[model samples]
Each structure stands twice: as C-alpha cells, then as structure tokens.
Target: MKAIWGQKMAKVPISWMVLLFMCFWAYMADAEYVKYKDSKQPLNVRIKDLMSQMTLEEKIGQMVQIDRQFASAKVMKKYFIGSIFSGGGSAPAQRASAETWINMVNDFQKGSLSTRLGIPMIYGIDAVHGHNTVYKATIFPHYVGLGATRDPTLVKRIGAATALEVRATGISYVFAPCIAVCRDPRWGRCYESYSEDPKIVQAMTEIISGLQEKKSQLVLNTMWAMVEQPKVSMRTTR
Candidate 1:
C-alpha cells in the first residue's frame, strides 16, 4: 500500500508541473502590449512624446534605409534600421510569392517591434509602373505612355491602384515618380520618366494624391530622392 502511495505521490509533481506550465502559457497568451492614444492628441505632441521615450541610437537608426539583402533581421535589430527596402532586382527568397513577400517583410517588422521602442519598421519597394519589379504583380504602362494618354485623372487612378497592391504586399512605402528629364533617347530607363519636360514631372507628383495618406498625414519615408543614373550606364549610353 505504501509503495502504491509513493507511486501516486510521484505523479503529483508531474501533474503540478503541467498545470503550472499551462497557467504561464495562458498568462503570455493574454498579454497585451499595444495601446491606442486619444485621437484628440496633437500629432506633433504625440510624436514628440514617443520620440522622447526613444534613445539617441534609436533616433539615428530611423534615418538609415538599407537594402534587405545587406541588412539581416539580426543586424537590423542591433542597428534598429528605421526602414528596409528591396531595391529593384532584389527578391525575398527563391520561389517567392506575394504571400512570401508579406511574410518576409512582416518578420523583419516583428523584429523591429520587439525592440524597446516598439517602433514599427517601414518597408519600401520600387513599385514604379504598377509594381513591375515584383514577380506576378500587375504591370502597368510606364509614365511616358501614360503621359501620352493625357489623362491626369487616369494616371492618379493607376497610382491609387498601385498603392493598394503595394500595401497588400505588406509594404507601405514606394519609390516612384522618377522625375528626370530623359532628353537622350538612348537612356535605358528613359521610359520611367514621364517626359523630357519638367512640367510633366510636376504634374505626375499628383501620384501623391493617388497614394492614400493616413488622415492627411504622409507616413514616414514617403519620398527618397534618387540621384542620377549610374556612371557606367551613363558612359554606355553616351
């Protein structure tokens, strides 16, 4: 009888261990880390309040945008990169799908959010011409052709559609509006520019209108002024 009682007592620790683990798991599951502030709060005041909570390193980190290939999630976590972009010709991984892109980007964002500041990381892509750069994405005509259509309204409409598709891929920022006077026909990317005229470039900035702004406020890193083409390409065209 004593031996049987000892055996039953041995089972008590195992049962208690299982119960304790379940309770801890339930506590973690119920944990809520996010909270919403009052809409009545001034935008800048809210931003300042949040910014003050962050360290100097985190602030400086927000200023840098690196290619995802170069900056791994671990490195981004260490450096606190404010943004990561998959430049044209960069893919998430082999056999990547739209869902794959979302998973990859969201994973990086999760790492960023895990930081002390909990600032969500922004992902950018060159969605120029209907996200043409991404595989299986709906490709739209370039600005030059769209400019010939002479429909600023249509152009804006396309931009709105592009924004929807781009956002669907779990990326909010787009590097578009390639505003350059491509006078030389030989230029490879001349198609990206609307026209040789600055007026056309000025008109097309209305793509800003097409992109859904959050409550009239442009989200972070909306514009990245790309400089002139590569020197090697320039020499090749010349």
Candidate 2:
C-alpha cells in the first residue's frame, strides 16, 4: 500500500510540472507579440513596434486606397487594405440611408481588422456638401454658394454639421472644401470650388476647424485644392 501511494504522489508532480510549463510558454508568447496592442505605450512606440512586425507586402497594402465599389471585405482582408473610399455617386445603394452606409463600412472595417496585425481601416467619402451621398442627410450649399455668403462663421457651422452627418455613416475622412481658384466659368467642377479669388479660398479653410471633432478626431488632411488655368491668357501689366 505504501509503495502504491508513493507512485501516485510522484505522478502528481509530473502533471503539475507539465501544466506550469504550458502556462509559462503562453505568457512568454503573449509578452513577445502583444506589445503594440498595449494602449499605455506612446503612439510612436506602438507604431514602431507594429511596423517592425509588418512584412513588405503588409506595408504596401497600407499605402493603397481602394474604392468601395471595386473592393469587398474579403479583398480588404486578403490584401490588408489601409483605406477605403466612396467616390462621387458611389453608395451601397442608390441614395443609401445613413444606417445602411454605417453597416456597409463596418463590415469592411471588420475585414481589415481581421488581418494578422489587426490594423483598422480608414473610410473616406465625398461628403463635400453635408453627406450628399446619403439619403436624408442635410444637403448644405455648394462651396460656390457658401463663398457668396462670405460668412466664415456660417461656413464653419456647415462644416460641423457635415462632420456629424458623415460620422453617422461610419466614415472618418472627407474629400471636401475644394479650394480651387476657378479661372474660368467653363470648368465643369467650378461649383465645387469656394471661389476664383485666392483670398476667399484661403479664408474658407477655417471650415476645417469646425469639421474636426475632439473625441473622434476625424482626419481633415484629404482636402483637394487644385489650380486650373483656362485657355485664355492674361496680359501682365509691367
């Protein structure tokens, strides 16, 4: 009886030793890989750590921005797409509701997050005039019209409202505030421009302050300010 009891006691330690080894291995593995997921770390540190882990393919995917109509969640997951955009007139449905847009974007976002590194995707839309692509969204005046108002304060309010309407659709970026100095009335995109005068275009940039929010920090870095010259040449006064 004593010999049998001693044998059983010997097996107990071996089982416990195996369990301890597994626990230690798991902790070490998690410590090695999860540093980037730690929110307590500085943003630069976290970014560096994550970048260090990414492969060249992953890095390239981070640079490519695809239109939503051409890409799906599966494609985003496979390629690890960094950004998705809805070009003018592109919506999940014809005049999709805000809720429908949110659902569509969220689905794509989930795919991006499911990659090996789990990086979130940034969604962009041509919300130039108050989420115009979405049904029931407030359609603010065009930049040309807003420029006539000469009310930077009112333009700022419009920007703020546009931001909210955009957020309701789960988009984080906008292609707006076209600061183009329309040199000719013949230009097709003139309505998108704030004014032909450089001064008014510069002044309307204040709208950015209102578009960005404290909590969400929607990126306002994608403004399109192009310079177009008409066919007619102007003579310079010497």
Candidate that scores best on TM-score: 2
Candidate 1 lDDT score relative to the true structure: 0.70
List ranges where model 1 is wrong by over 4 Å: 1-40, 184-189, 213-238
lDDT digits (tens) for residues 179-199 of candidate 2: 677878897888877888877
lDDT of 2 at 162: 87
What would the per-residue lDDT of candidate 1 be over residues 1-238, giving only the tens digit for each residue? Answer: 9999999888787778899999999888667422323357787776877777778899999888888887666767888889887777788776578898888887888788777766778887887788766777778898788767766777777778777778777777777656566788897877877777766655665665676555321232232123232211111111
Question: Candidate 2 clashing pairs?
Answer: none
What 10-residue stretch in candidate 2 is worst by lDDT? 229-238
Give TM-scores for every candidate, taking all chains together and pairing residue i with residue i: 0.68, 0.80
lDDT leader: 2
* Model 2's TM-score against the true structure: 0.80
lDDT of each: 0.70, 0.79
